[model samples]
Target chain A: MPMSPEAQALLKAARKHPDRPSDEARTRMRRNVMRAVSAGAGAVGATTAGTAAAQTLFAKIAGGALVVAALGGVVVGGRALFSSSESSVDPKNAPASTSTSTTVVGTSRETSEALGSTSTAANLDPTSDRVVASSALRTTATPSASSVASSPRIATAPSKPAEANITSDAASAPAVESVDVLKEEAALLASAQSALGKGQAARALELTNEHETRFPKGALSFERRAVHAMALCALGRGTEGRREAQAIVDRAPGTPLAERVSAACP
Target chain B: MPTPNALRSVNAPSAAGGVIPVAATRGSRSTTPPKTFDDLYDDHVDLVWRALRRFGVSEPGLEDAVQEVFIVAFKKLDTFEGKSALSTWLYGIAAYVARNVRRSQRRRPETPTEDAGLHLTSASDSPEDEVGAAEALRVLHALLDELDDDKREVFVLAELEGLTAPEISTSLGVNVNTIYARLRAARAAFEQAVVRRRAKDARQLQKGGLPCR
Candidate 1:
């Protein structure tokens, strides 16, 4: 069944007018890919020097807010006490960033400031359904005075068994669903971090275990694993903690997160 | 077109450890050892971008879709065993990403249909040629939308992208015979569609509408 000449001509014309990504988009996406690649590409052990260069690049590109996001996860998790709702946080009522773009790198200081108060406020109402807004995730990522002010909720949340809260809704698109997933991921990791802070290493490990089950490839997985490693260290499981932390350090050397992970169980 | 290393089987990276070193190539031969990840991005970004469009990824989500593909590629860079052309491996990734994007789009309350093919960039210098090319592309997309996902993919890869049957096989992970079967069915469906469209245009021309190209 050969295509007629007319069909062939149509394909040729369509090919001539094929869609292309604009220069700005191409460059932005390239930078993003490079950043992510640099963080983990070196783990292959194929290029030691390349890995060294990647480490430097990772340090350069991983803005201050990224480190905060990691540290903030700990701060926010410490305060979040899980209550009733098993549903994933709704992206519809999520911060304005969720509707427009899936990822709003929350680099601005104002955004970071807002996150601290927002997470604290959300934690204040354990009775209300805990909504994981994009800002709340940012709060977990970027530590603020307000986030730190909120005392640990490890006493309240661990009394009940941890529930799966990241079940994504079919009504939401991936962009919105990602926001929801990130929120749930942040909440889980935040609670785990909080547990570690309150000397409840077992509770922290439990939350991280729940996180692993819900979001195996979650955006904040690195932080979750880091907290998991820390929890292991706190529980006197030094060998396991050291091994876990070493892999993360190997995968992304020089980054602040890896540096912190390396300190685990030492 | 089958890339020079079309038949190469990419060995999935070992559990222990081994790097998937990239190789750079010119027209039909290897020119240099595989360059940096940046080189891979430079060489194949357009292929991934257009392939995503052809695969029905909506324009609004296209950027994220492309990023997702590269991110996966970057994470799985060690999996590149050179078993297939780098482009083929990337295409396979694009196909998967596009499907997910579409699936998500469908779940939305209002699926956006603003993807007018007329906005596609035209290579023609003259206004008349540009209009003709745009109309042709519009017609092409209309026909393509009628086919099922499987046949549509085979048609796009075979007719528009010009990947040989074997190359499409490797990209799609479908058997060669199956690729041939879908391509044949898609061509026949496309030809019948073109004939119907031409007839409709002729009727419209008689009714005092613009001339059919």
Candidate 2:
């Protein structure tokens, strides 16, 4: 069958109808892409600063070689203590002894201050500390109860008193632990950024996944997710990446991070 | 229409390849490089909108579908090997996106016609003429709705979107003969539906003592 004259006329009329998207929509989309790129860059900056601050603090506290030597001493001391009579102590009685030790250690104000600083630093810089702690803890701590119960208390005892004294001494003390975490996060972000910049999207995606698993609550978590979305986009998984980006935006609204997510998702 | 220079060029022997003449050879020189997904949207937005209008997609729905098509194209651009013209490739994407949009709308029982309103022909004409044109377009849309999806897609691509049959075939991944057959069937179905609509409208106009023209 050939086309009827009326149907042809109708099609011609339909073709004559105009339908382009508005200027505003195009502008919004461009803005979204730009925002995602910016957020990834910003996360990298914050992480780098935090990493530098943490390394400086670590150097000042341990004095490099002495800190390494002290760590070796602690490991040897731990093994000896674990083999001693303390290994036979009942599990239920351990907390009481540990608390008592902490109290004794806290009696010295200087020791308390040092411990407080270290704890604060750990919390602030959890990214590096987390990696370091996981690896260090896995290697040094014997699974035996005596080693787990007594070692941390004894090791932290001297620093606890110093930390206690400095509680009020540095009211304005920057959160060193958070900074370290930020630095580690920044390094991950930088690696992802570099990979993405070079169009190695699959590598960026792999790095993002590793970062997320290792540092689920790391400061750069949201930013890492956004980068992951970008990697997805590059890989031609736009719909999936869009959904992930939307999730990031919903979870972290109003932050610079959210803006980045929306940008990528959009 | 062949110029003397064109004939001479065709006759001239190639320095490198003895059998093939330089000018007569296909794929010898690039026209425009194939458009990327981003390039497609940036270049043919107007064409996309026109295609959407033919499918009777509402303004907002059209916007969403257009964006979806381009986004999908962006993700899948690596697969596009410049085998077909960019416009043909894009039309296929737009058709797929529009069909999805229509299917989703069907599940909700909302009237796309009511939502779309009579605004398509309402802008440039007198109120009475706008109403007539809108009413005519509505009838045309009803007729289009009667055709099967494949036929309707071919019809829209060829008649409404003004693509050549070969272009439609390439975009649709069908043989040229299939496009021709679908276009013929689509046109016949559309014509029958339009005649029925016009007859019904005439009867109502006469019953109400209104002018039928």
- The TM-score leader among the candidates is 1
For model 1, how does the per-residue alpha-carbon lDDT over B97-151 read when each residue is reduced to its tens digit?
A: 6665566556556744533322212211222377777666666676676677788
lDDT of each: 0.51, 0.43
lDDT at A179 for candidate 2? 25
DockQ (C-alpha) of model 1?
Answer: 0.14
Considering the two chains of model 1, state its CAPRI-style docking category: incorrect
Best by DockQ: 1
Candidate 2, TM-score vs. the true structure?
Answer: 0.43
DockQ of every candidate structure: 0.14, 0.07
Worst 10 residues of 2 chain B by lDDT: B16-25
The window of 10 residues in a row where model 1 chain A has the poorest summed lDDT is: A152-161
Give fnat of each prediction, in order.
0.33, 0.15
